[model samples]
Target: MTTVTKNKVTDLFLENAPSFGSFLSLREESKQIVNEKGLPAAKDEEYKFTSVSKKLEQVITDFSTAKPIAVSKDTIKDHLWAGFEGSYLVFNNGIFSKELSAFENSGFGVQMLSESNAIALGSIAKAEKDPFIALNTIYFEDGIQISIPRGKKVDSPILFLFFNQANEGQIISPRILIEVAENAEATFLEHSISLDEAVYFSNSVTEIKVGQNSHVHYSRLQNDGSKAIVVSNFETDIHRDATFTSTVVSLSGDLVRNNLSLRLQDSGCVGNMYGLYLLNGKTHVDNHTNVDHTKPHAESNELYKGILTDQSRGVFNGKIFVRQDAQKTNAFQQNNNILLSEDAIVNTKPQLEIWADDVKCSHGCTTGQLDEEALFYLQARGIDKMQAKGLLLYAFAGEVLEHINDESFRNYIDGLVQERLGSNF
Candidate 1:
């Protein structure tokens, strides 16, 4: 087994190693991390419920020999929003697709990295700490560098679309880094979708820096093909008086894992995290979030909800840390799950670690089925059984959706939620 796995890693390395000369040192560092940690095992506390290493190994074996699928401009034209007035940064199978991107009418500063520049300053610490992130840094072909000038708020939201077309099973790694200057504001919307019949792997990493007094809002949609396996990370650094918020909606995927982390480096920072996962058909999703309050008077809030049916499974783990000197820190976290089927499973854990004496912190976790009485009330209102259930579930899922400020995007997601609830009826 050891020999087979070693050869598999070698095969991938030979095929995907970066040709960008300046990244040699950084690649070596990331490779060392991958070699030391490999993939997280079931026994690893952080990955106890999701033992994905074995599954990832199997997919990678196929990735080593798979053929590149065809990607045409027309194939993805329908995926973009009509009359979109903002710029777009697109990636197909983890590589930049110039033919499909729109950079002509961009309002904010947008630049593509020169191999040397992206590697020298990209988020390398996360790669050194996590194997999935390490794999991305070593093999990523190209990445985008987005700069929002000080005091300038973008007129429209920027869209970062990652569309995968894997005719044969393969591995796709997408890397992105964004910097918002002091007093600047911007909104980024990301959509990851698979339009192929093959089972692929998507290992994506995004690093965002919110400068002092800046504001950043991000919304991510993970609706990959049913057989796709995904491991992604969204890490942000919050500077003094900066605010950051993110909303993640996971509607589909076979084995999905997401890590959302925020670090409050200076005083008066505020961070918000919200997510909702609707699962069915043996799907599995795991979300792990961490917020570090390192300075005084910082605040962080997180709420994640899940709805599981059939034999689907979901996991949520949230952690908030307040340093000793982070006096007046305010942190709150909550996780709620509803198992719509008897065979469904959900594991939720909320944690708080505070070293400061004068701070307010709270955490809560809950898992339950639909409210029987409420369902009955809806049924008594002349609604059929399936319709009543859909109504209740729709309301349950709307809490997180309501936070979206984009009308068109929110309505688009609302239609998906409605379709999801009306399934199997």
Candidate 2:
């Protein structure tokens, strides 16, 4: 009988040897931590919501270094970045492609980082254990670093473009780190688009640290192919009196998982998180968010909604933790979903763990089908059954979409939802 050995994450690290040699001195330490502790199993309290064991098992077979992949601007303009203005940073196969990017260095302090300069920042270490992040740090050839001078307000939105070409059976990992100076304000838009029909995997991580009293707005649009699989993690650190808001929209993917963590480290900080996911076919989408309030008077609000049709599945796990010293903290979370087909499945969990008794915290979740009365009322108003259903679904999602502060972006998302619903409107 022949035996097949499953590839372990350790194997990927070993084969890539030199790429990860940067951590060689600590390889033994990391290996011990990973192999012995490894990634938490499905039972791990932190990862209990999403099962990554089977997914992690799909490690690289040979583990060779990645070569630069060429991309063209004309191709990007024709396929992605169709409608948008401002700066664009394009990356392919986890390597930044400068030719495909455009920038206006008009005094906002936005510039690409020289390799040496990025290394000096010393912030990348926070993402070391993230497998994809490790891969990017080791293999990533180049990436853009946007630095807003202290107190500079970036009026134009900065867009990060990750394009996955038609590379069948290949995996890509992209890494990004943003630093916002005190009292700085900026908006970031990241989108992944591809024209290929192959089943590619995009594993990426983004870390943002908001300086004291700074404001950062981040939005991610995941519009990969239905056959594509993606895993993304975003972590942000908010300082005193800073505002950090993020919204994620997942349109398509075979299996998509997004993990977002926000650490409110100082008092008077505000954290806001919102997500919308639509799943169909056999696609599975999971959105998990964690908010930690470590100081007094911090506030956090989270709301997520999902729509599952066909035989697809959706999951949402939102958690809030208030430390013992985090008195007067206000935290609220809610997750709602609608299942269109009997075969569709939706799992939603909203949790709050508070150690301070003087805090006001609340969490609630609901999963159910469409309102029959609302549908009947629309139908009675002369709307066709399918059209009526689409309208109701749009209205249900509009409440969440309305929270989006940007009107143009909200309209763009509304158009996407309308097209997905197949409503003539």
TM-score of each: 0.93, 0.88
Task: Give the per-residue lDDT of model 1 (tens digit) for 338-378.
Answer: 99889999988898888999999999988998898998998
Query: Whose TM-score is greatest here?
Result: 1
Task: Point out where model 1 deviates above 4 Å.
Answer: 1-20, 63-69, 81-85
How much is the lDDT of residue 164 in candidate 2?
79
Quote the positional error of residue 283 for candidate 1 in Å: 0.8
Model 2 scores a TM of 0.88
User: What's the true lDDT of residue 201 in model 1?
Assistant: 79
Provide the lowest-lDDT 10-residue window in model 1.
1-10
